[model samples]
Target: MLMLPAMARSSCERVIVSADPAYPPLHWYDGKQLRGASIVIITRILTDLGLPYELRYLGPWKRVLYAAKNGNIDVITTLKITPERRSFLIFSELVLNNPVAAFVKKDRPPPFSKWDDLIGLRGGIARGNRFGSVFDEFMDERLNVREADNLETAFNMLLANRFEYVITGYHVGQAYIASANIDDKLIALQPFLIDSQNLFGFAAQSPCIAYLPAINKQLEKLHKEGFIERALAQARADWRKTPIIGKN
Candidate 1:
């Protein structure tokens, strides 16, 4: 493991990004620069592949999706592809399968046991996040879905009862509930149905696909080296020790 020097920072070819300060374990702002699990994984993959690139770090998820869709960005890390999006982007092999579910205040009756159940309920979800094309397409128009600026805010809204529920990753749900000192008020219920999801290397076409295969290659390497499990376990441990501050 070598540290990148000042001369190394400007070396890569441009890889488009929109990693604002919101997403965690995937992307984050360290009060100085963008860094996180996805960034670490992406950096290791690109560096190992000898691919030089720059990150755009767009502030909104919608913008990130738009950039990837329009060829404004070469690739977006940790995106799940669905049938509807396949027409616009190519995906690398699965980086990860994130579990998704409805997070609600504690002691509440289960409002969801199926995708169709969420359709009639008013809920919040981060814009551009998808469960699957079928679910995403339905979410696009059928549900009374409110768009939150980010996952934490969505959890905030849920706690405030601004919405009936919030659709998001189980990790995010757990983190937010713990971080906000709201575990007593919120609980993730019935994973209901599981989506065989993948955080794909989203590319506009072949040239970019050339770069993405390297990420899968590195992921395979990391898997064999036990890096993935250890990193995730570390993240969970760190998150658990960090206490909730204001919302207590």
Candidate 2:
């Protein structure tokens, strides 16, 4: 079993959680409120613990990270655990594996079967999305990738040939394609970039860090009972039912 550090003794009045507004089936803003598996799981954990909490939609993914880093947000419901993020956030145990994929236009798939195949080709990713440390480093050193403000823009850009591909979370990418009715234009390349783990991150300076131990324990219980998988499926179905929130 993975052991978390000793629990903090500070008093936490409330836990404010947020996530990338574009990452559906994990977390996203559905026109008005945040919805998806990550939000469902985290909120359930907090409720069971009897913790007072508020789920905020702070806007873009970049601003959400900024708020968490500065302790303006108490928790990021789901995100890749990155070394840079460790500076100000204490992460919970690995919640689940999330695959990162390269989305290319169907009629113009790039020469991509390996990581090196992507070098020298132009790609785009939503701002604030990271695959894993190794892939991120490789992308920075050799890839010509643009960071769009959101996934919708990245996919539209891919369609417009602004770039050859859009690298993003596989499920969320699928959600966007489906919601926008653009599945005919784009498809994810085989063999994902990386299978990254999704985790809950608490602002290191926030009193909410005190609940890390309980959160991890509840997460373990949920995982063991298969609640996480069920939640993910339900979220995907729910997303399909909700009206598409923004322009395609």
Candidate 3:
């Protein structure tokens, strides 16, 4: 039902946007189509810009990153900046604030008050996903981090006592817990490890890389109009309707 603006129509050039189909509330593949807060926001921005684009649900997080790095994809709906990623991507202004937290089983919560407390404990993270520069550095040097294919897999491993905790976005963790009917069994550790600002990014070599400034400008306008907040709320409500649990 959503149509591109007449004034914003484009030629044959199309921007290929890649996103992790398993990351919900933010975005996820609903059997046949991609839908979520970021999807809606990006859709509006692209439509307003009159840009031809295709939204692809290539996932497992790692594959999405690989595609973006190789310029096989033009844009990623959301990602946090990392030094390695910076080599191949140019990021837009902040798109959303995602609070990173550690989730643990309720019966055996770890005593973690500071970053150093995480050392020695087995923790799970999505393969090829970075929490932040500092956390990633600490993880590399001190923590015993186990990699999973996706957040759900990591959470499952945590529940099976394969790991002491699983690190992921707070909202995402909570959504999965609820969806899996394990809310009473799992709890997100307080205070958060990091508050990451999610951003739109373009492959450095993509022809659409030139559109960064325009995208940022539109993102700023969307923020000012409270469009982002409204879209997020709608996304949360919609996600709750299905409450999908598993790979995505």
List TM-scores for all candidates, in order: 0.77, 0.91, 0.89
Over 1-248, each residue of candidate 3 has an lDDT whose tens digit, in order, gives 75442124333388888787877788888777788888898889989999988987675677888888876778888878899989888899999988999888999998988778888899998777788788889888988998897887898899899999998887677777776789899998988889888898788777776777888999999999999989988888888789663343
Q: Residue 108 of candidate 1: its Cα lDDT?
A: 67
Identify the superior model by lDDT, candidate 1 or candidate 3.
3
Candidates in order have lDDT scores of 0.64, 0.85, 0.82
- For every candidate structure, what is the RMSD over all alpha carbons to the true structure, in angstroms? 6.1, 5.5, 5.0
The model with the greatest lDDT is 2
Deviating ranges (above 4 Å) for candidate 2: 1-10, 246-248
TM-score comparison, 1 vs 2, better candidate: 2
lDDT of 2 at 115: 86
CA error at residue 87 for candidate 1, angstroms: 3.2
lDDT of 2 by residue, 1-248 (tens): 84222123256777888888778878878777888899999998999999989888888778888888766778998999778998888999977778999999999897778989888888999887888789999999999998998788888888888898889988898888887888898999989888888999888988878779999999999999999999998988888788355321
Q: What is the lDDT of residue 180 in candidate 3?
A: 79
Clashes of each: 8, 0, 1
Model 1 segments beyond 4 Å from truth? 1-21, 116-120, 140-142, 236-248
| Model 3 regions more than 4 Å off | 1-12, 245-248
Clashing pairs in 2: none
Residue range 1-248, candidate 1, lDDT tens digits: 75332223332355554443455555555444555556666666777877776766665667666656665566666666677568767776666556777887786645666777776677998756678766667777788988887777887888787888898877656765665678788887686445545565454542546566667888889778877656655555555564322110
RMSD of 2: 5.5
